[model samples]
Target: MVAAALAICLRQRGLNVGVMKPVETGVGERGSTLSDAEYLRAAGGAVDPVDAIGPYRLAAPLAPLAAARQAGTVIEMDRILTAYERLAAGHTLMVVEGIGGGLVPIGHHFNVRDLIARLGLPTVVVGRATLGGVNHALLTVEALRQRRIAILGIVLNHTAIPSGPSGKGPDAIATRQGDSTVELVKELSGVPVLGPLRHEPMLAQAWEAGLGKVAAEDAIRTLADLIMQDVP
Candidate 1:
């Protein structure tokens, strides 16, 4: 979702934005609801075909490698790179979202990190702002750093505010926990940390409105500025 919003922001800034998912899981057959790739395409207002945007759309909502295996298929890196280059050719910048975390498997032996290294794109780590986020966020940053990938920044997203033992309310202890994760991550992560993007469920139902709101955010704007600096 953050990636989609970033695409929207880039386009709003007057850049010819291109979006790609490389591999998308749980994408239903033709006539089904909008998949992540479709949402991203809409975000950028791109006219590219869905095949070029995603390249691989697996039916099962599993990891790319697992879903491809279930469908009796294989994920070829060359195919993905071909699609990426095709889209990149006509756009100012390509926003390629990872299938999952950096370690997500694509082929039998390849992972998302390998794909990123191959694409040679700087990445913005989007972490969930909740308890245990520190570990997940830091580990991801470390993984990218180990591979010598340029770290753009981190965006901590608050997916939801769950109820604590005190019961459901804004003052729930879990809310505080979620809020604290952002601070904890910032204190520890040496790389620039961008957002604690508030939970916005509307994005699933209203693409433009939801993304428009996110695009107008100061954080998203700042992140966009950073991305522009990194990309040629």
Candidate 2:
């Protein structure tokens, strides 16, 4: 959803942007399902072919390696790289979304970290803005740094509503923990905390509306501007 939101924000700025998912698992039922790549393409107004947007589409809804194994296919890194090059040649900027986390295995002996290193693109790590988010964000940042990936920044995405069933906002515990998570992730990772995005329920509404509703908010615009500043 963050990827889609970012794509929308970039498009609103009149940039020729393209979105790619590289590898997608958990494809929904045929003829009625839109994958992440599809949503991104629509959101970014991308003209690239579907194959270029997502090189590998797996059905098992697992890690790429496991999903490919279940389907009796192997993920070839060169294939993905070739597709990326082809897609990159056509766009001024490309927003490539990775599957799962940094350590996720895309193929035998190759992980998301390896893919990022190979692509040689600056990355913006996205994590949930909830309890325990600090640990997850910091750990992912550490792993990326260890692999020498250029991290542009971090985006703490608020994916859930702060209010609970009782019609009250987040409890004291959650609020305190979330605040600490944002501060600590920046301090520990030594990367700019690009900005915090408020939960945009419009995303789901847009999806349900068949991508007709392009959700744009202040947070999305802010993050988009930060990304543009980071882009060389």
Candidate 3:
């Protein structure tokens, strides 16, 4: 969902965006079901074939190295990097969403964080905005920092919003959520909060069109603005 949303957001800004599942595993005879290459192509209306999106489509749906091992194939790092560089060439920004958590295995000895550290791209760790999320968010942030990856920001994906009446209407609700996120950002490494993504149909459309919803637009733009502010 965050990948979809980011694709939409970037597309709306008129930036060329490519979606890659990169190291996919667990296919029967077809292919990886969670593949985002097609979705991104369709969303971006790009003529580039999905193959150009750099999918390592594996057949076991396990960790890349494990799946490759199970299938008697090698997980080639050079190949993966080549694919990523190919798509990243013409775009100002490419949002590469990982398969699982920050620690998912990528190879014989490396994990997902290792992949991000190698790529050296600014990364936004997506986390659920629910109970226990703080710990998960902070720990993941720490791990990524330890790996030396530049932390772009934290994106709190709200799976479900509490149902209630707010006297402040949408603006109020947004303000309250924004304040909470700002507090979290200040407390955690001073990384900006990219805002919460509420599950909604408009969000799907905005994502497809690459347009940021009101909240996402403000938050993403603010992060961009502030992150640039820190640039010397």
All candidates in order of lDDT, best leading: 1, 2, 3
Q: What are the Cα lDDT values of the candidates?
A: 0.88, 0.80, 0.65
Worst 10 residues of 1 by lDDT: 162-171
Q: Which candidate is the best by TM-score?
A: 1
Instruction: Please list all clashing residue pairs in model 3, or write none if there are none.
Output: 8-210, 12-210, 25-61, 26-59, 26-60, 26-61, 27-59
Index of the highest-lDDT prediction: 1
Give TM-scores for every candidate, taking all chains together and pairing residue i with residue i.
0.94, 0.89, 0.73
lDDT of 3 by residue, 124-231 (tens): 788765555667788888888787788878877665454446533344454466456546654875676666655555644444333345325555555545434543
Cα RMSD for candidate 2?
2.6
Q: Give the C-alpha lDDT of model 2.
A: 0.80
Candidate scoring better on lDDT of 1 and 2: 1
* Residue 204 in candidate 1, Cα distance off native in Å: 3.5
Winner by lDDT between candidate 3 and candidate 1:
1
Q: In model 1, which runs have C-alpha deviations exceeding 4 angstroms?
A: 29-31, 163-168
lDDT of 2 by residue, 124-199 (tens): 8989777878888899999999988988778887656456557777666666777777888878879878556766
lDDT of 3 at 49: 62
